[model samples]
Target: MHNPRSDKPVLVGVESLDNVQQLVRTAGDLADLGAGTVRVVTVAVKRSDSPFRVFSDETIVREFADSSHELLDRATTPEGVTIERDVLVARSAARGLLAAVEETDPAALVVGWRPQEQRTDAVFGTTVDALVERAPCDLYVERVGHEANGVDSILLPVAGGPHVETAARAAIAIAARNDARVLVFSVETSGDAAALAAEGREALAGVDGPEVPVETTVRESDDVTGAIVDEAAAHDVVVMGATRKGSLRRKLVGSVPRRVVDQTDRTVILARSGDVVGGPLHELGRLLRRW
Candidate 1:
């Protein structure tokens, strides 16, 4: 049920068999983040008609080899990491991952975010959207760095409020794991922006802001959308909040996350809310939805 080698910070990779290739690649990439042990806990959905056997035959990943058990074995074998495979014959991707995480209880849950325009983007739809709002542990909503094999500084566009805390906390762990830095930025339109940003930083005081030095910035601007997009373009990864339609004025009006993801080449890690604080990703999402 757990890796006995070392606590060495865990990164839980979640996905259906459709993402086996990506999962294997991500597991290898994360291994380089630290000498610490890495485990790739993956789930293959086993429906009545589409049993686990179907996935076994189609897996292309040499490291993972498509077999859930084999993937976990190989990961822990050559290294200290452990892989736990599951055949969750479930109705949804999120549900399958939720089951795996509950069973595994990894340190930090990592999930890839493929662009929506691609042909295989069905995997990035409401399923992931809901999961982003609800997964266990701090969810790493990744996109670009997976292809590059590593991430640079995490460009977290902060609003200088408690709302950005969840995203900042998640970014801290991810940055530490990836040997990355955190660029905490807040775009100012007017009205004592520095003072306002100080207030926001105060909210983050109690959050788990790992050793990775977080560089906070308060930039003056008139346009919120353009400033955010501009801020997103500078970093290798963009971390922000996905405000609800009823409460998130910026997101509801301009769909800030959708826009940032669209206009920037960097990967977007959209944390839905910080209200739930440091818990599983799903708990935060579920808590926010009630608000």
Candidate 2:
């Protein structure tokens, strides 16, 4: 099925000018595919209400707004994509981004991630961690990598889930923009590998978007994560669905997408569809994590 949010704008939350090109480019491609606009946003922390301050809160906000505009100016937006810029003030970046989602109601929220030493205690960094649970729209987390002159191939690993369609659509959009090819890949631990491959092909067939060269591959591997990481070495970008497991399980065991992001040097875009299935129990788990 086609993404229901395709007609809405894409909201991108950028932390800094560094490594923001990929984030903006990805957002632009998605927006371009949907014939929508891209809203690039940054958050400025509101100054504390202390009695003593050298600069007024208004002055601080003005400075931040200027810097934000400069950062937005430096972004390399995709061709044929409409772009908008904004600066939001909130106590925290996560809160500011969540607020933007509420106000703008974008089709999806795109953010950038820089690889760091994996923390056993965290799923993603602070801002992303908050959005994973609370954001009302689809989420795209791009793991920034070394600059690439162009994109010629996209690796899309699918295992059949709510987010598969979203991932496929993103991969197809990016491929259309760059004249690249997409490989719909799957790893079967047991059962029939042929059936798994067929399933992957079907998933790609269901996505509606600009036509692009597409291929499907299925392999038998006991190590799903390793298989994906190895295949990613040959591709410029990897687009895959976020784990369907509950948040608590992901926190403890780590998801395949998370592992692939950590192990691969290639840029990875993890897509999570907004049709969250976990009911009240899932919400309770998220709340407990906050405490």
RMSD of each: 7.5, 3.5
Writing each residue's lDDT as its tens digit, candidate 2 over 111-185 gives 887766866555777778778767777888887665456899999987766777777778877898899999988
Off by over 4 Å in 2: 47-60, 118-120, 192-196, 246-254, 277-291
lDDT of 1 by residue, 1-291 (tens): 111122334455555445444444444434333334455554444455664545542352232444655444333322343344444434456666666656655545566666656544233466565455455454555563334346777776655433465565556545766778777667777666667456445434545434676677887778766887787666766777554443323332125666677677765666544233345664666567558
Quantify all predictions' global Cα lDDT against the true fold.
0.54, 0.77
Worst lDDT 10-window in candidate 1: 1-10
TM-scores for the candidates: 0.63, 0.86
- For candidate 2, give the lDDT of residue 27: 90
